[model samples]
Structure formats: C-alpha cells, structure tokens
Target: MEFYGKGNLWNFVEEERRNMHFTRSLSFSTDQNVSEPHESPFVSPKASSASATSIPLSPMSPETPWKLSPMHASPSPSLLYHCLASLHRYEGNVFSIAISRDFIFTGSESSRIHTWKRPDCTEVGHIKASSPDVRAILAHGRILFTTHGDCKIRVWDVSVTEKFRPKKITTLPHRNPFFLFPKKNSHQHKDYISCLAYNDGEKLLYTGSWDKSVKVWNIFEKRCVDSFVAHEGHINAIVINQQDGCVFTCSSDGAVKIWRRVYGESSHILTMTLKFQLSPVNTLALSSSPSSCFLYSGSSDGLINFWDKEKTSGRFNHCGFLQGHHFAVLCLATIRELILSGSEDATIRVWRREEGHCFHSCLAVMDGHHGPVRCLAASLEIEGLLVYSASLDRTFKVWRVKLLTPEKAAMEELVVTNDQQTEIEECKMSPVLSPSWVEKKIQANHFQ
Candidate 1:
C-alpha cells in the first residue's frame, strides 16, 4: 500500500543509520505539519501555565485540595515543572515513545528508532527499521516492536551498548499477505498501523490501524493468529486487562467497547459498549490497584470519561468525567492512584484519587512541552518521580513532580465538589465532532 501519512514527507537514508547525528540541531526533514486544534489561542500565557515571577495562591488552603489555583488554570508551577535535561533531538514530530527499566526509545518520521541512556540523557544508538515512518513502538525486554505506515509490524533484537547493532528478527507480514487476511473491500485496516498492545502472559500482540481492524499477532511466529473488526471508524488505541482477560478498544466512532477472551478459544466476544462521548475517543488506559481497577478514555473534545462496573446493568458504567483541558486529550498515564493526562493544549495535568473517593482533583499542570503533547511515560527516581512527555513540536520534556508527601495527601480532608456539568446525550448523526468536563465527586469503586 502507498503511504500517505504526515511522516511520509521524509525519506531517510537507511545505510546511514549507524552514522546519524546526535546533536539536536540535526536536520532530517523540512516539513512541519502540526494540527491547528493544538494551537488554539484561547488561553493567556499567565493563566495557561506556571510563571516564575507570579505569587503563589496561599498554598491553595488544604481544604481545597484538588481545586487548581489558575481558573481553568493548573496547580502552581513550582509543584511540577520542566526538567532542564530535556532535549530536542528529533527533527520531526515524535509520535511514539517507550520506557524500560534502564533506557528510553523514541520513533518519528525519521524511520530510525533512537535510543538514549537514562537518568542522564545521552544518545547511545539508532536502528533504522525498514519502514520510513514508525507510528507505534512497544518494548518488552531486548526485543523492540514497531508498527509503521506500510501496514507492517517489525520486531528487532538489540543491545544498550555504544557498539550495539539492531538485527531484524521478524516481520509480521509474510509473502502470503492476503491469504490469511481477506480483502474486506478496503474497509478494514490494510493500511497504516497506528498503535500496539502486547499481552505478555498470552504471548499475543494486538495492533490497531487506520483501516479500523484489530488483528492479533503471535510475534514469535511472525503470523497473525486472530482477526476482528472492532470499530465502525478508525481504531485509535487498544489496552488489555490481564486480571480479567478483557480487551478495551476506542475509535473515531465516538464509542469505547469492551471485549473479553473466549475460554479455550483463540478469539474474543464483545461484552458491552460504552457510549455518549461527545467526540472521537482517542486513547484508553486501565489502572489497577490492590482492591479495584479504573478505566479511562480520552477524546478529541478534551474530556475524560472513566468507567467502572455497576450492579444495575453488570457492565461498565460512565462514573463521571474530569475536565482541565481546553483542547483534545491525546494520551493518559497513571502513577499509583494519580492519573496524568497529556493534551493538545500543550499541557500535562496531574490528578490524584483518594483511597475511598471516585472523583479526582486536578493537582498540577506541567506545561513544558512546546507543541501538542502526544505521548507520556513515567519512571521512579530515587528523589522524585520522572515523567517523560513527547510533543509534535519536535521536542521531549522530562518533568519532576513533587508528590513526596503521600502521608500528607492522605491526612488532608477534601470536600469533593461538582462545579462543572456535562451529560451523555443521544447519539447525534453528526460528523463525529470531526475528530475532534467534569465536576463530579470522586468515590472509590471497582470494575470486576
């Protein structure tokens, strides 16, 4: 298939991968294709982010825990800010980023997956995958899996050494492409692969695509074992819950559906559908605590709807929504009981969930990235929590969030308040908001 993605503008020289430049000034592509929704001008510079000279809002008074000081504003900048260790290494938009125990990997329009030494940001190596545009990257050990615009997924074996070289261990599409995958009249995803999720225990890899199909692949065998049509529109993201063996997928269709594995069978069955989203669902994430699990979905309309099990229908219920962004919510990352979401507003808002509460309070907003925040990764530092965020502005920022006082956060009493209101209305026959709030109380619940 011919590639038409925004990454296709660059044609890198594969043979020169080992000799790629390490400086941020390196030029790989001349095209700068950024979406307008991320560049909205509705926020004043002071109200949108943290300021160095601004006075603090009396520490927000412990009683008003999650109420951010800024009015559609985020928490104080001092609580969460950008790390000076940030680097603008990529020449184009950094689409996908992955984090491991000791290293970080990022893929972009350059087709080469760049590796850097962690704790101290330094370029170590670069591997040129065959595909010129790598859309998604997920790492499981020494093995690196990447999806691209060619409708193909490739696996690589590599090392973290200065002299490390990447060898192409496997390619998903064999010679008999259409034999295993039938022609669905071009409605299905015979196109670019957008996102990927790996089930370590099941040894299965799930790939979502622009063609709107979720195909399960056995990475060890380089063969697609199972295939299913997940959504009526293009599939954006896929995440699995290992505890219950459930798979959740969100799409441009403005719906988030739940699917479960069939016992003794290789396929899955659709269980329930969660709808009423005002915009196309862009991403979904599942966070599990010792007692319960929480499901979060982000949309183009800049709202996040969380789902939990309800006894009334025995299906996932739209508990409530969280609102701190004025643009599309692009990605979400969970750190313990706290949820950190990145958005086209070019900010990352941090929210905390108390043990017994279901509603979350906005704690701080990290406005370090220059462009629309596309992806996020988190790790532990001996002294603080490190959050790595990638953006369309061709730069990545590392943040240091001060959540050191876990005991203080627990002792503090929060009077959960609902100041904003949005409802799920009947599905309108509109253009899905073209893809493309909550002031609800937080309560402790589970989705078993």
Candidate 2:
C-alpha cells in the first residue's frame, strides 16, 4: 500500500519494526526538495510526531544536572516544538554548548566564551580566555569549566548580576612560583582536552583528552589528583554515573571502558570494557532509574549502541542499537527519558526508551544546520524541554519540545491521516506542473 504522507510512512515503518523487534529501523530520506534557509519563530518537525513515542519520566539526575521545577504536562495530543531563537556570531564555528541554570554558554574557535539568557536567548556578555579555540565546556551550579586548544582547563565562578562576567577562579595544574620546572606529564594534558564531567558529591572534575588519557581534578585543590591512560586511541567523550562514582569513557580505539575509584583512594581502576563494533565511538550518555540504568554510546558509523546495566554484576551488557543518521554520530545529550543525538549529517534525532524494556523509538528528526552538529545541551522546562545545539556552521539554535502521551498521540494520528487524505486527493485531481529550472538545480545540489 502507498503511504499518503511522510508522517504515515514513518509511523507505519516504526510500528512494523517495533512488532518485529528490529533494531535497525528508520532510514532517513535524503532526496527531499531543498528550500531556502530561513529562521522560523517555531520549530517545524522534519518528520511528524505521529511516528514518535515518549516514555514517562522517572525523577533522576543526568550527568549535566539541571535545577528543574515541576513540569506541568500540556493537554494537547499533538507534539509542540518552538525555535525560541537562533544564536550566531562571526567567530569561528561553535564547537561546544553548555547549559547551567538559566544561562546558556557557547564556545567556539575564538577564545571568547559567549553567554546567552534563557527563553529569549539574548546575548548577555562573554568571558575572554587566554587561548583560542575552546573545545569543550561544562557548567555545574555556579562553577564553569572550559578547555582550550592549548590543552589547558580553566575554571570560572559564574555570578549573574547586572553583568554576566564570570570570575576566573583557577586553572588546572596550578602554576607554582617555587616549582618553575613542573612536570608536564604528571600535571597537564599532552593533547587537546576533548570533554569534561563533574561529580558533585565528591567535588571532583573529570577531563578526557585526545592524548588517550583521563585525569581527575580536585576542584577545591586546583590540581590534578590522578591520571591514567583510558584508551589506546584519542579519548572522545567522558560521562560519570553520579549515582555511583563509576566513570565511562569512549575513544577512537573503538572501545568504551568503565572506571571506578579504588575504594577510598584517589586513583581509578578499569572495571569493565565494552567493545562490540570496530568503528570509533565518539560520544556517550548515561540514564539512571531506580529500576534500571542505561548507557548509550554514539559511534562513527552513525549508529547508537546502548547497554543495560546489570544489577547483580554491576556491569553493562550489550542491549541493542538505534540506526538512522546517515553520517557519524558526533554528540549526545540526555534529559529524563529523552536521548538527543547530533550527527555529521547535520541533523539531530530524538529517541525515547521504553520504561521497563530495551525498546527505543525515534521520536523526531530535526534538520536545519548547514554543517555538522558538533555539540548539544538539554534541560527540562516547566511546560516542555529545552534543547540547545551548536553546529560547525557557526550558529546555535534553541528548541523547546513538548511530547504527547501514547493515547493522545494515537488520537492525533487519525486527525493527521484525514487531513493528509484530503490533500492527497486534491493533488490527484489537480493537473501536474513542472518545477522551475532554479528549483530543479537546487534539488540536484541537495542530492549531490
């Protein structure tokens, strides 16, 4: 049977995959006609929400914890997403995005770290750094951390007064006047710092570097307390399971390793290794619940592999994978039950995991960026969810997403089907028209 609308097409496919227990499901369409780029006040889903699925939220804190207020569900059956604003600057491509409290931070090839306010996404101020090309940024509570191309990490104390100037607290590998010849191998990263994670309970910071090592820093001490080689290749991403102090790191070596602190010592020891695919893993995200926990790793092959945390063994077992993106999966962000992935294909796919099973469904595919999506940040809003994505195209966009219950989604689908039917019937009765030469050229370029 022919599908009338793209919405129905994806929905039918997803439903079939769900029933068949298939992992490699959606194949994103790349042959759509091209349109001129324009900023819309609202977010239009590239795919309809009728094909989407959402799960209930269990009160849990993600790696990047947000101070969220109680969410009041919308009564609407259809999904709602708004493009609150698009933030852009002339600086080089945005490499990282971080959300802390009410402020959003964007780091780029420039030394300045730009800041924007929530809701409106208005520019406040920026913090100038000592070096160019800020690669990674992590903000927690009032403390903010940024890594530069110099392979140095800087810490800042953020205060939101009239001006958004954050004070420079200290730099990692604290410079000592007495010890002029400090050992670089023991103190500073040998290569670019790629990612950062913070453990609030221990007040410690984790930094993963392209030098294939992971370092633990004591926030108060302003020094690296422990360091170890994490992977055989460049370390790409690092995430911490705050519930337990277990740290997870992925690398270009095509491996994901788990590390745990040695009892009361500051050092860490490898607990387990997860390497199923030969492709390089680029990013990771962790989801925790009272009943079970999950670990998601995005790799170079444009597939997301997830693992189920075993309660008795305290190890992650390979569960399954999510397939959709046409290019490498570059970054991942998790909020509650939602998993958002940015890819080299310049699109973001939203996925929701079923409550008690390993089942996952692609909720939506968002496309707007002209280049690879480099980084992503997300937080829960009172009425919906806020997602911030920074792209290599030198722009960052804020999206507010609202999901519907399964019952509401089913009802909404019927209405969408009726509307689609009328449109299809009208097109059938109308005479066919040829597109203009310019439109055809644009479409040709899109496919090329």
Candidate 3:
C-alpha cells in the first residue's frame, strides 16, 4: 500500500537509527582509546592497600553528630539539571511520547516498541512488530493503546512496574482503509495512524488515522464502538479531553475539529471547528484548568498557536502564538502553567503562562541534539519538575529542574573541599623539587 509522506517518513526513521548507532560507537571508541596510558593525563597512581582502607578518626564520642553553623550555610541554586541516560534508540524518528504511572513509552517508524522507567529514563524493554510505523501511544488504566501506519490500532496490557512488559491483546482493523489512499502501490496509502486517546471511565479508545477517519473502540468488548470520517485529508493528530467529553482532531487539510460525545451515546456530534489555512496541525494539547479552557496546537509552519474555547469565532478570538522554532513544531506538552514544545529545528522550548491570557517569554531553550526533536513527555508525578524528549537523532533525553536542598548543598561543599585537599597533596608528592631547595642543598655539598 502507498503512504503519504513516505519518503520523508522512511528517511526520518532511518536517520534516527543511523545517528544513534554512530554517536554510541563514537563515544565507545573515544573512551577505549583514552584508557591507554599515553592518551590519558589524569590517571591516579595505585595506592597502598593499607592507606586506601584506613581512615584516621579524632578522639571524639562515637555518637556525636556534626552540626553546621548558620554562617556556613549558603543559598542553593533554584534548579539542578542533568541527562541521566538515553531511554531508547530508534531507526525512525519518535513521533509520540507518553508516560504512564511507572513507565515511559515512545512510538517510532521502525515498527518497534521502546520503553523506559518514568523519570529515571532506564531502558526496560522493546518489541518489533509487523505493524506499519507507530505514531502515538496512550496509557489508560492497565491497557496501553497505540496508533500505527498500518490502518490498525493495537491494545496492550502493560505491567505497571519496572519490568514494563506489554502483552498484545487486540487489534482493531480500519473500516475504510482504502480511504487513506486511492491508488494501489501509491506512496500515500501507507495509512499513518497519528493519534490515540482513551476514555477509560467509559471504556472507549479513539484513534486518528491517515485514512482521514477517527475510530472509537469498545475496550472491554474488543470491537469498534463507532467510526467517523472526520477530516477531509489525513488526520495528523487527535486528543480527547475525557473530563469534558470532548475530542479534538486536526488534519493536513488545515483545520481543527472538535467533537462532543453525549454521555450515553457511541457517536460523537460535531460541535465546532478552528480553521487555519497556512499549515497542517501536527500536535494538540489541552489545559487542565476550566476557566482558561486553553488548547495548544502546533503546526508544520513552526508557529505554536493557542486557542481559547471560550472565544467562539472571528479575528479577535485567537489566544496567542509562540514564535521561536526555526522549523516545524512537532509535539507539545502542558505541565501546570508551563508549555513545552519540541520542533524539527532540533530544540525544545519551555514557555510559561502569565496572568491575562498572555504567556511569558521563553523560559528555556534546551539544546544538545544534532537532529530534530520528534516527541516530548513531562512527568505528571513530579509537578512539572522533569521532562523527557525523544529526537530524530535516535536518542531520548531526560531533563530535570534541579531542586537543591540544605543537605545537598552541604554535601556539594564537602566534595569540593575534599577535591581541593587531594590536589594539594598531589602537588607535594610531585618528583620535581623547588629551585631554592636545590640551590641550598648544592651550597651545603660545596661546604662539605
């Protein structure tokens, strides 16, 4: 079957894997070469076993506790940050990222699965299946739902622990897979499934696919509850606000449609539409707040547009726009009042919402990768303190806002002092003597 954007899609996935392998191999080789004696300059001499194992103690009460005076205390930095580890390396650019209560999940083009621990970013498991590429992943209750390029959606029962093993349960076939592509063997028929959303309270799974349709599935019954032709072109994204019983979908045809499902019905009734003709909407995210009722959507044109549900229509109704990314904006996440956006320009931007519907200027521009950032996930458990991002570079990065406590500050000080003392001792043990000492010894030898 043909697929829309097939060239770009295949290249994106292949580039990711190639970059990941290249970087890992380069680092490994560099470390190996640096281990040789002539290549390393900071190697320490082997220490005597007795000296290494022994630590002298002052004659003080064994139970005595150390106390710090107020004068010795210092203010700590508001945040500390570091890259813990890369979660997974994909052959295709990761298009979606989701974090459950315990595990981190990502969808990539190689038709493979990648998972890691929440917040820690430790690799847990992976699966390579026959599905066309996966575009989005949603975790609801014990089940994880994924949308793919094969015009099918799969449901998996995932273990909510460190092991992260997911068992495939059901696959919902597309009702109108042919709608995705008119020509057989055409590149447009690959049927890229772009988004997945679930209403666990109602036991429903909703998927947006390139077939230009949104499908609702009954999770318990393992059957499609309802299917609707919601877009004129490929449905690139979909998000369901279960709290409000509202589902939002966007397509390459350049429009955002909102559907409201009646409390007891299977079909979704169309409510409203937000139209933009310049670019296709690539991602969508809803705010948790009610009064603000804000929804953010990123587009292929690199502008992050904010829409307020309260404002119905017309020129003055737009909320605001985030303009910084040089290329297309691919993904977005909301953590409290902050909004995070990942772009094809190879940067992740953080923005904060201020009072009166306006957002503060960019809070931070995270940079470290050489390729486009394809997906981003923020920890709901950490109160907007940690962020995880996946890129076309074939790596996932975990970032945290460092919160330094009194204990951590003291430990850092102690570490610095110990390092300084070690450097001083090393200086004293050096083989070269001072010129003054050598001259005095030569004078004494002449007198003798």
Candidate 4:
C-alpha cells in the first residue's frame, strides 16, 4: 500500500512533466495546423483546436498561469476595449439601443423607453407610451421615433433637460376616426414593426415590419407617404446612407435590397438586391469613410458578410466575410472602420477592417451577458470608442475602448490567444473526477 501510494504520486508528477514538454513542442507548431473555417475574423484561423485528438497550445512557459491574461485582446489599433458599466433592469428584455447627441436610449418589452446620459451612463429619464410594448426606438437629433408591438409608430420631440421629457408629436396614419374609417386603408402597418431607419436629408422615416413590407413616413408631415412589399419573409433591419439617400433593408428571407428615392419625388425605386447565403440576416451596418465604404450584414449562421462599394460602378460587391461567433449575430454597429457584432452566443465581438484593404481581424470578444445580445450602438470618442449594448438578459452595458498602436495590439492579441490555448490544453490534461475520488466512491458503493 505504501509503494502503491508513492508510485501513483510519482507517476502523476512524471506525467505532468511529459505534458509540459508536449505542450512546449505543440506551441511551436505553425499556425497552418488550424483548419476550422469559423475560428476567427481573419482569413487564417488562429491557434484554435484543430481536431479532437490534436490540441494547439500557445507559446508560453509552463510556470505561466492562464488566468493572468485579459479576457479580450486589442483590435487593429491595438486598442483594448473593456466594459465600463452595466445597467440592469427586471422590467423586460431590452430589444433595441440607440444613441443621440446626449442621451442613449434603450427599448424593451415594456412601454417605457429608458434613457441614460452620455460619458457616465447614468439613468437620466424615460419616455412612457400608451402602448404596452415598445420593440424599437430611434433618435435623430431631438426627434425620437418608437415602433410598438401593437403595429404602430409614434413620433416625439425629446427635450434635453436635466430630466428627459419627450413630448408626443403625432402617431403615423392619423388615429382621428373622423378622417379615417376602420374599413378604409389607414396606411398604417398591418403587422408588427420590426425595425426602423431614418433619412434626415429626405425627411423620411423607414419602418420594416414582420408583414414583409417597408413603409415610408414623411417626418415633417407625420403621415405614410409610400408603402411597398419589400420581401417575402419578415423584414429584420433597415439602414440608410445619408450621403446618397439610399435605403437598405434586410429580411428573414435571406436577402438585402437597396432603394433610392425618385428624383424630386416621394416615390422610391429598387436599385439593387444582394443575396449570398440563405441564412436569415438579422442586422445591417454601413461603414462609410472618406476613402472607403462597406456594408456589413449579420446573419443567423454567425457569419458577417461585408460588401465593398465600387467607386466608379456605384454598386456594392461582396468582398469577404468575418467569422467568429458560434451562433446567430443579432445586432451590429459600426464606427469608422470598426464593427461591433452582438450574437446569440451572448458575446460581442469587435472587428476592424484594414484602412484600404479587404482584410479584417477580430480584435476582441466582450462577454458579460447571460443571454443573447440583442442590440448595439457605438460612437467614436477622442480617446477611443464608446459602445452601448442591450441583451435579452435584461442588461445594458457601456464599454470603453482604448486604442493602441498596431504593433502593441498584435503583441497583445498573441498573448491573449496563447492564454486561451494554454487554458484549453490544461483542461484537456485534467479531469473533473480524480482516480482517488472514483476509488473512494467505488469502495463506498461496495460497502453499501
């Protein structure tokens, strides 16, 4: 018994020694060993596990503890983004997040649209509506537009005071019974309003609905000016290009279509259609810079497909895709060259496109939510960027991203990836139930 105990301990120690040597050898293995297609944002996969038998290890000393590394890595600018604050409410699942000049707005399953102040993310005020559920809220200058589960849209003028008080402007398709009858076509949406987009230049608000239609409302006039069937499936999201007044809509039918206003008229005409993967696209973001323009679509298959607009051709062409999330990407927001995607995997990933190139790299993965992340909003700051995210877990988070140089960011990413790989290797080497515990359990079972 004495020899058995000592020998077992010696074997364990020797096995650990061998494991350290094996891990070191594996660490030096080339990145070409990784073959998974969806392992990273970059074209080439990082040092993720290639298969069940072969595990990749990061280049690190045996004495290094895996927990010492930060959860997220710095992006292209080598900027490190970390969560600054979290806002929690048991009211209901937050469905949308929007940012204006001063306030950050979040809509939930409840009728109230919650507001938080900029920089500090302090709960400043809220807007209550007569409807029972507010599915989406959007802010343009001082104007607030809310879409309800009751299939209606409301306009409000948000007063920027110490306390936020939004004055009701008017509801679309005027509810006046004398002007419109129940049997008559009210021009209002026939089904639930799913998403909204606004064009300040055209003074139009575009609402996409589960009814598979897109409705255009004249903001100043507060009435539906045009309506059209946009897709065969429910419309999921819509975005507008301010420079050209082009509206882009994505639907559950796995298609994206672009529309342009007829010259000097309220009518619109379909300009283009983009459909690559059959996966249902949930969100869309258009990143337009002085030098480049790209449109990104997040879909149910966890792929972020982006299209680059041709300068001379004036058409968007499918360039490449960003793959990192393990589940459906529910929401997406872009600021400058950086894109933030919130997924059903309960993680928010940051990706940056090269200034003038087609290449993109996963900078970081921010995770704190216990449920699917639903909506995201981000804005550029002097120091870095500010990200506001809402999730089905009924939580809102504010993140501050600090930009670092490319060299420093690359080094930081290497360290983070190494830490993750090391942790995975460690998990593989260890078991939850030790032999000693199993032996004890077996003996107790025999006795019993």
Over the stretch 1-448, how does candidate 1's per-residue lDDT look in tens digits?
A: 1111222212212212223343332122322232222212122322212110112222333333333212222112223233535656444568888877667778787556776557775555566554557788888887788877667887877655555556777667644564676443322248778888888888888888877788888777767777888988778888887766678999888889888878978788899898976478888888775566789998877898897764355477677999867667889888788788988666778887778658788866555454567888877788567888887656676666656344443342123223310100111111111121011100101211
- Put the candidates in lDDT order, highest first: 2, 4, 1, 3
What TM-score number comes out for model 3?
0.68
Q: Give the C-alpha lDDT of model 4.
A: 0.71
Candidate 1 pairs with clashing backbones: 70-73, 357-442, 357-443, 357-444, 358-442, 358-443, 359-441, 359-442, 359-443
Runs off by more than 4 Å, candidate 3? 1-81, 87-90, 161-165, 174-190, 311-316, 380-384, 402-448
Tens digit per residue, CA lDDT, model 4, 301-368: 78999999998988999998999776678899998888999986677888888877889988666665
What would the C-alpha RMSD of candidate 3 be, to one decimal place? 17.1
Model 1: lDDT to the true structure: 0.64
**Consecutive 10-residue window with the lowest summed lDDT within model 4:** 39-48
**Residues 302-365, candidate 2, lDDT per residue (tens digit)?**
8899999999988799998999876668899888778999986667778888888999977666
Clashing residue pairs, candidate 2? Answer: none
- Clash statistics: count for each candidate: 9, 0, 14, 2
Model 2: residue 8 alpha-carbon error in angstroms? 38
**Could you give me the TM-score of model 4 versus the true structure?**
0.74
Determine which window of 10 residues in candidate 1 has minimal summed lDDT: 436-445
Q: Estimate candidate 1's RMSD in Å.
A: 13.2
